[model samples]
Target: MTGEPEGPDFDVPVGLFEDIEDLKAKLARLTAQVEALTGGDGAEPGEASADEGEAAGGEAAADDAEEEEWQYPPFILLLDPPEYDDELRALIEWVEGVLVPGYLAEPSADARWCHLWWEHPVAIARLHAVWLAWQELTDPASCGYTGPSVWHRDHMDPALRELRGSTGPFAGCVKGEHQIDHRMPGLVPSAWTHAED
Candidate 1:
């Protein structure tokens, strides 16, 4: 009896193994180049050439600087006189184009909205907060697939509720109306205040 099996001969495609080896060589070269660029002496990237303690301290300082820079200022704080107009224009575009059309529903007594919302400082602040949160949350790089839902639940819904409530800045406003005379009530007189002279 013959030792060889009688099944059809199996063979790998020509040059397949060579191609795989070529890819591996290319990958190794790229990895080595990246390591060289990133300071591949088993040290973290951007580690200083100084002593160990000095490097550690430097890293800490860099981290602190990054944290400080990362702190986001509120909309009111972002109003540098030079950049005010441009910033406001961008905000208005987002509000009118994306926010109003996508999220805001028909304004009612329970949920008031002013057409000239920018005139109200409180409305501007609230809307800016919402916009910032939206920017952070809706970005796939910042937050994963569920970011939009999280923004809706944690940021947009609450801000809108407060901003559009009956006691909100738009209290004097309604659908199809913008109250030119709308004014936020002033605080009660202080104890030192006296009768007009």
Candidate 2:
């Protein structure tokens, strides 16, 4: 009967099943490696990756949301002239009674007051006027015999001498030249009396 081995029966594809099994085993190994790397400490592998991504995103958002830095302005405190002794005293009283208390109670109020004092010319002028009024009140004899001179030359002369010794071009000028022009020479006027027009 035709016994030539029929050419080795070539119907099935060569190595097809072995290739499929090999690929399945490789996939399983890869999955196991991923699980080992990510799945520890009771958390799923995917959850850790998600959490890390969220954290990175939050940091980026925070960086983007940063604000500009702030800066402070410069300032100075001005003192009244000695001639305005009455006004200075009044100012000290006002500061002690109203300003210091307000500032202590609310820092923002002090800041606002400073801003107003710097920005408003009228406020500065008002302060100057107060000082002028005080100076006039403290030494009523400044305008000569036109009004009663309550200020004593004995006391004022020494003050003038002391002022002359002070350092500056205008120091001695107050008593040496200016005093002669502004001294009170008659009876002392009442506190309420206004100078003759």
Candidate 3:
């Protein structure tokens, strides 16, 4: 054989990622590699293969119904409003009982609890993603890979960085710029005060 490299793009230049598309392509490749190694599946119930489909189609009709009952964007926070659904009651209980008092309420954290943010749709969505990431990286029953290091690297860091970032949902609310009213804020969004002028 002649003196030549064996694989595709064997002569790729060092600065190939200087292009936006090339950078995106490289990122996609990296993400795929990580997913392959870590067993990360896509985000929907029906996103699995035919063999997996048969499993979800089993005697878990109630489970399927629950999944189908979910709203457009499946943020756990949205389950709290309208004040009647039993699922909402449970979600609120879990957040208050576990998520908030344990993690979000910490003074050492870069994140400060925003009781009124659940009212904002965008905040609801972002925080829901964080919560999902928490479930993925923490719950011992989950099948995929997990660890504090992995959680911080893949989930916790990005979620907190975005949610508690300078221009995030708490943009003006974190500092003294716009203050949350201290008039007895509680678990419910309505109980919390807004940053209204």
Backbone clashes under 3 angstroms, per model: 0, 0, 0
**Candidate 1: where are CA atoms >4 Å away?**
1-74, 180-183, 186-197
Better of 2 and 3 by TM-score: 3
Off by over 4 Å in 2: 1-112, 140-197
lDDT of 3 by residue, 106-193 (tens): 4223564456665544555665565556666676534345554676677656766776665566654543333333222463333234
Task: Name the candidate that leads on lDDT.
Answer: 1
| Local accuracy by lDDT, each model | 0.69, 0.37, 0.51
Candidate with the larger lDDT of 1 and 3: 1
Clashing pairs in 3: none
**How many backbone overlaps does candidate 1 show?**
0
Error of 3 at 175 (Å): 7.5
Q: Let me know the TM-score candidate 1 reaches against the reference structure.
A: 0.56
Query: Which candidate number maximizes TM-score?
Result: 1
Worst 10 residues of 3 by lDDT: 45-54
Question: Where is model 3 more than 4 Å wrong at Cα?
Answer: 1-91, 105-112, 144-149, 174-197
RMSD of each: 12.8, 34.4, 14.6
Residue range 22-127, candidate 1, lDDT tens digits: 4554444334335544886464543322233233355444443453345354575468866666667778999999989998888899988888999887878888
